[model samples]
Target: MKAIVCTGYGPPEVLQMQDVEKPRPADNEVLVKVHATTVSMGDHRIRSFTVPSAVWLPARMALGLTRPRRNILGIELAGEVEAVGGQVQRFKKGDRVFAATLQGFGAYAQYRCISEDGPVAAKPRNLTYEEAAAVPIGARTALHYLRKANVQSGQDVLIYGASGSVGTYAVQMAKHFGANVTAVCSTANVELTQSLGADAVIDYTADDFTTRPDRYDVVFDTVGKASFGDCMKVLKSGGSYLNCTPVLPSIQVMRAKLSGAHKLILGEAPPETAEALDFIRELLEAGKIRVVVDRKYRFDEIVEAHRYVDQGRKKGNVVISIV
Candidate 1:
């Protein structure tokens, strides 16, 4: 099997194609022929060892002292089950599936063995492999934070960086839950965000978004580029501010939650579960939500894909065809 091997933590150039052994399923696991996968912002940061100065030591220890703990970089995948272990009951041979591999982080290969009980589910019947591969991490993150904030219908919601992978999903999912959404992105993505059902779109490049008069019930920062204080200033009393790109438990967030009128929420990715995927799958098949593919790369072009995502301007997901 062919895989993109991360030589060490540095640049996208460190990712190189190489022949590797194919994975085999163990008891309670299924072997999948990987069809597509994605290079998320998480992938880029891990590969480059980009961590805040405060968490650098801990991040290095968790990822690896000298190089990535895992040589393969992809976190989610869409694939077909080629084989299943004898004990596997939830999946069988030929089942089309999509999954998050955040636990082991080895979806860059042509084949991956996943535990059937993990965040694995049948792919949405209406989606292509590339589209399904884009869902798990980005969509799941957006959904988790929204639910955490207890976003209510008829409440005003603001999402910053509403053009990146998670931002795109956040906009649509918030609308699905009946929140009045305001998407903030660069001028180039105003049309894109509007098409995702954001009730209003703010062109951050054209003006300061915090200066808007309408206060929000919830403000989400998907790209971690928004100023924390600025986001708080735009929220209504008792409103919530959620930051997706969290590295450590923030002291400021803790203090604000205790002393301020608003809530500052920071969370890691929720546990990937088949239940969540199944729910999202139904919405996808129903055409209630759609995926935006900014670019598609072949398996051999993994390095180039990372480079593109590092540019930090993708409208939505960037996928790599692996089969």
Candidate 2:
């Protein structure tokens, strides 16, 4: 099997294409021949090891000390089951599936193994491999934070970075949660955000959302571009703020406990639980959520794909076609 091997924690150039042994399934695992996979902010963070010190330290202890523990770099994949262990019952050799690998991040290769009880799900009938590959991470992140926000029917919710991968899904999910959605993005993305069901679009280049008078029930800073204090200014009494990028100032952590008007919630990708995967699959089947892909790269050019995602301006997901 061919895979993009991450040489070490550094720039995108560190990713190299090489021939590696194909992975086989264990007694309780299913071996999938990957057709598509993704490159996202998390992949870049791991590649360059740019995560915050607090997260970096703990993650280093778990992943490795000086370099990465695993050489393959993808976390999500959509593929066909080529073989199944004798104990596997939910799927057969020909079933198509999409799944997230919580820590076994080997989807960059042509074949990878997923446990029968993992986040793996039957691929939505309407989506292609590339499209399905983009959903697991972005949709799971959006779903986790929006549920934390607990948006109400008539309340207003603001999403920062409303045009990025998670932001795009956040806008749609907020609308699905019945909140009147206001998306914050640059001038170039106004129309795109509106098309994704944002009730209003705030062009950050022209207006400051935090300085506005109208207060929101929830302010979701998908990019972590603003601090908790900056976002708190526009929150209504009892409103909550969510940050997808994980960083919390000590004062804000303390303040959240004391004030009803302000609160902070940090996000993580939902655990690869059965219920969470089922919920995402249900939303996809109902047509309430969709994948937003910005670019597709051939498996051999995965190094270039990493560079594109590292640019930090991808409109949505970056996919690598493995098959």
Candidate 3:
């Protein structure tokens, strides 16, 4: 098997292609031959050690004191089951599957072994391997946060960073829940956001969304670029503020929640589950949601893919074809 080994946490150049032993399934695991995977912002941050200052020490300890504990850096993949252990009843050889490796991070390789009951599910019949690979991280994160906020139908919902990976999925998912969606992005992505079922699109470059008179029932900051205070000003009195990337000020919002005025949600997403993947698959099969792929790179070009994602301008998911 071939894998991109992350020698250490630093520049994208640290990722190197090398021949490695193929992984085998354990008694309760399934061996998958990867077909496609994604270069998530999480992957970039972990590879370069670009994390929030508050978690710097903890991140280092969890990832590795000197180098990555896991050599491969990918977090999600779509692949075909090549073999299954005797105890695996949910999957079998030849089953097409897509899954989120989460903290495991070994999808950059040609083969990986995962528990049959883990965050693995049959790929949607309508999607390609590349498309399915893009769903787990962004879509799952978006779904988790939206559900946490308990977003209601016919309510105003604002999605900041609407052109990025999680933002793209948030816009569509908000609409699916029947919320009147407003997407905030630069001028270049106005049309793209609107096409994803956003009821309105704000060109952040030309206008300050917070200055508008309109208020939202839910304001989601996917990239953590907006100030919590500014976002709160645009929220209705009882509206919820959801920040995917929380900073120090987010703590104030959490404490203020004790007053019972507004809801504040900021934290790591829940573990990815097969149920969530199945829901996404149903939406995909029904043509209710679609994968937005901004670019595709060959597995050998993973370093270049990381470089592009580091710029923080990709419209949706960036996929790496593994097979």
TM-scores of all predicted structures = 0.97, 0.94, 0.97
What value of lDDT does candidate 2 attain over all alpha carbons? 0.86
Alpha-carbon shift of residue 318 in model 1 (angstroms)? 0.5
* Global CA lDDT computed for model 1: 0.90
lDDT minimum window of 10 residues, candidate 1: 246-255
Q: For residues 169-221, could you state the per-residue lDDT of candidate 3 as single tens digits?
A: 99999999999999999999999998999999999999999899999999999
> Model 1, residue 47: displacement in angstroms?
0.7
Instruction: Please list the C-alpha lDDT of all candidates, in the order they appear.
Output: 0.90, 0.86, 0.91
Which of candidates 1 and 2 reaches a greater lDDT?
Answer: 1
Show pairs that collide, candidate 2.
none
lDDT of 2 by residue, 98-154 (tens): 998756798889899999888898888889999999988778888888887788789
Model 1 Cα shift for residue 161 (angstroms) = 1.0
Model 3 poorest 10 in a row by lDDT:
246-255
